[model samples]
Target: MPGYGAPQNNGYGNYGNTGQGNGYGASQPYGYPSPAQPAITVGDGLSWAWSRITDNPVVLLVGFGLWTVLTGIGVEASYTVNGVEHSYGLGIPGGNIISLAAILIGPIALAHVGILTSSGRKASFRDVFTFPNFLQAFLAILLSRLAILIGTIFLIIPGIILGYLFSFVAYAAVERNLGVTAAMRYSMRLLSDNVGLLLPFALIGFLLYVAGAITVIGWIITGPLVALMTTYAYVRVQGRDVARYPSQG
Candidate 1:
């Protein structure tokens, strides 16, 4: 595996294979890159993610569908409150607690598939269930939201900024197996230099989701696309290379 002073290898250059396993296993250097690391634009990340989806359309659909069903079961189970028809589940300030299962598990599912896709391997249904560092991931999600909530208390803008800053916590925790604080800190530093690009990337992804939600069937595509785009960005920003295009079998 490549490290700090390692020479570039195909774009994964300085950073090597995340680890040896089905998922992005263990610590594979989520540290700072050389000062001159190339900046991956939002377009680059989206395009790479799109190519990956296009290449594995059927499998992605199956995988994401499976994920939806698995997570949806938990979400739906808590919908009824005192026999009332609560379609949206237990509500909170932003979203509902029932929906939190999806929010928490979505990224981990994507990270598993994305890591395989980026590694030039075929994505599979099992990837959705193959959670790496799930406990750390769960803790990171809760802690990051708590921090964001605190920031939100201060003012809306600070909350949004913290949201953007800590956006990659799940990736760091699951992919690198970092602890809660370490994962939060890693995510902050990862994007500290890329805020200008992060805002627009996030906005476009949100718009895609909203548009997809309106169409209903569109979520089948846009949902994974946006998640994979984030995965691409996270890998690239770490000074690693992603399979920009799909590999031929």
Candidate 2:
């Protein structure tokens, strides 16, 4: 996501259509903090990411590990062509399946942090996996990701726009007890208000993610970074307030 940058500076605008970015999100906030904004270092991003991975390593790992495993499973099925069968369909690999599962698990993650952040960022996964709410957590992960996916495709540029726009949709779902649509819109709103910060956040996230994904150890290590960032984004953007998930119990 961060690999691209200000169409003009990074030459991504022409990259999208010519390469795509399309001056796409400029109509939104289109404003970043003044040049006075300090750079968000690679280490800071990694630290935040690392803290999350370490904080709730178990559920986070279970949630994302399932996703990673499912991710590796591939999303194809077989079909018939003329008389002989061809090779391909659409089933979402273990990676996507796990990610999809995260939507459902989102509220759980929120509950994990909601009380903790409210109590002053002391959340852990201990209470996040109480069983009854697990399904809700799974749904939140699946639907939210899918909704955002749909929104992103609304227009190619818009899709990229939503890709960045709804960056924090999962967190909103839990913090606000929001359904998929509401949370997605909220994320879009947050990005519309803060698109500039997103690119940099993404750039850092991407670097960490790529580095982690470069190897099995990297993938295992970095997978949680993505989750942590997404979770942190949700908490920070939603603010530290006790929001109820839709009664997952």
lDDT of 2 by residue, 1-249 (tens): 232222222211211121222221111112322233223344444565565545556655665555555455544557887899887534554546564444455445544443233222333355444322233334545665565577767756655654576566544544344554655666677767765655666666677678875675666766666656654444334322111111111
Tell me the tens digit of each residue's lDDT in model 1 across 154-197. Answer: 88888988888888887776666667787788788878877776
List candidate 1 stretches off by more than 4 Å.
Answer: 1-39, 66-98, 245-249
State in Å the error of residue 135, model 2.
8.8
The TM-scores of all predictions, comma-separated, are 0.71, 0.53
